[model samples]
Target: MLYWTLKYVLLGPLLKLFWPTKVTGLDNIPKTGGAIVASNHLAVVDSFFLPTHVKRRIVFLAKSEYFTEPGIKGKFKKWFFSGTGQYPVDRSGGSAGQAALDTGVRLLREGRLLGVYPEGTRSPDGRLHKGKTGIARMALQARVPVIPVAMVGTDKVNPIGSKMWWPRRIEIHIGAPLDFSRYDGLAGDRFVERSIADEVMYNLMELSGQEYVDIYAARAKELADAEHAGTRVAVPMQEHARDATRTPETEAS
Candidate 1:
């Protein structure tokens, strides 16, 4: 298959030689069955490095734009992403977001490994951001476990706005699977979904050792861009520094 070919024969060896990945706790990943691999988004290379290190094929829900671009380069990107086990989903909110969630749940139910960035977008400042509830909802809907993964040093290899990647040591830490069976049959409850999302984020914060920001990554990016553009926007103080020790169980209680 194309996925195996790329990971083993073509791109994987090249990436390993350059980056020299160090992986730990890889056995935490289930050898079989469906699970959601939730991770913190740092840089674009996080996607490439994580899949190559893992033995199983990880199907990620990529933004639709990657597959919809026009012309020759676009065609190659579409083919590459598709051949490497990525499926395009619209990131726009409302119906499009729901559609993506449905697609993820369907994949999980079909016993496939689904890689998800719970933060929804890459962090603008390398701090872990608050997670979207879509991942929690999908886990609940599919009755699957959620595995927390942390990719360290990927930001250095491919920083934001960089067109080329540099050789850097990469560390991948895979954490134990999280079970949400206690909240079974509560897929549509917004409060439950948020709690689950928070729990996953908490694990990622612990694993990656990155400062946790309670704001969504997309919003943080917008505020950062505005400030960079000389707009006087009141920046909201992040509460995570003070509340960093709080866990989801404590919040739920």
Candidate 2:
């Protein structure tokens, strides 16, 4: 398959040599069968880099926008996504979540790995956000193990505004697979769903060590945007300081 070919032959080896990342608790991943990998989303690299480090292929429900672009770039994006075990989901949960859940269940039923970020988007301040119940729904539907993964320091290597890759030490900490068979028969009730989602978030918090923000991706995005705006506000002050340092009166001359 192109995925493996590109990974083992190109990306994986290159990452090993150049990226030189470290992985911990990788054995927590199930070597066989269908399971869920519940992880914290940091940077865009989280998706590609996670897959490269894993032994088996992991399928993720990526945003539909990634597949809907123009020209050769779009074509390549679509091809790579499809070939690398990713499927498109609308992300708004308007019929899209169900469609993805359906596909996810199918993958699990067939004994494959399903990768999902319960936070739904990259953490705004690199802190874990309140997880949506989609991950819980998937586990309840599939009746499979959910592995907790925490990827640290990746945000710095490929932050939101960075145009190029900068080397940053990375660590992938995979926790043991969580067993949720205790609530096997109760999957539909809202209260039960929230309870399960909370438990999932708790485990993720332990693995990630991020401050838990109780909100969805949209709200987190708003907060992150505000922080970025603050950075812009401080930039002028920093520039002023630099300018003053260069002034003749401030200089030794």
Candidate 3:
């Protein structure tokens, strides 16, 4: 398959030759069956490096725009993504988001490993952000264990808005799987979903040792962009409630 050829024959060897990636916790990955690999998104290459290091093929739902562009380059992009075992999903929220979640659940039900970025978007400042509940919903609905993965130094390799990829030392830490079977069939409950997502984020925070922001990465990026543009955006106080209630040990560094 193209995935194996790319990983073993082509790109993977070149990446390992230059990048010097350190991966821990290979034993944590399930050899068979379905599960979720929940990771912190840092740079665009996060997707590439994460899967390259893992033995099991991971499926990610990439944004549909990547598959819809018109041109020879776009056609190649679609082929490459497909060959890499990634499919496109509409990122538009509401029904679209639900559809994507359903697709993830279906993949899990089919005994496939699913890669999810709980933060929804890459961190603008390299700090872990609050996880979206969609990840929780998918895990609970699929009855699959969630493995928290921390990708270190990927941002330095392919930095935000950077065209060149540097061969930085990338570290991947895989934590033990978190089980939410006790809350099975409760994925529809918003409170339960939020708690599950928070638990996943907490594990990621501990593993990655990154400063944890209680706000979603997308929202944080928006506020940051607004400030840079000289436009003040008011952050709702309710969003900070989770931060206020956290213990001192779990406080953002």
Error of 1 at 135 (Å): 0.8
TM-score of 3: 0.91
lDDT assessment of candidate 3: 0.82
Model 1 misplacement above 4 A: 68-71, 90-94, 234-253
Using lDDT, rank the candidates from best to worst. Answer: 1, 3, 2
**Model 3 weakest 10-residue run by lDDT:** 244-253
Q: Which residue pairs show backbone clashes in model 1?
A: none
- After superposition, the stretches of candidate 2 with alpha carbons farther than 4 Å from their true spots are 64-71, 90-94, 224-253
Alpha-carbon lDDT of model 2: 0.73
* Each prediction's RMSD to truth: 6.7, 11.9, 5.9
lDDT of 1 by residue, 156-199 (tens): 99878886789889899999999999999998887898899999
**For residues 134-222, what per-residue lDDT tens digits would candidate 2 score against the true structure?**
67777888899889888887788787766566777788889988898998977776567677777877888897787886665546577
**Distance from true position, residue 2, model 1, in Å?**
0.8
* Local accuracy of candidate 3 as per-residue lDDT tens digits, 1-253: 9889988888888888989998999899999999999988888787788889999998888667777889998998787887676867765654556667878889999999988888877889899998888888888888999999999998899888887888789999999999999998897898998899999999999999999988888788999999999999998886743211110010011
Q: Return whichever of 1 and 2 wins on TM-score.
A: 1
- Error at 189, model 1, angstroms: 1.1
Residue pairs that clash (backbone atoms under 3 angstroms), model 3: none
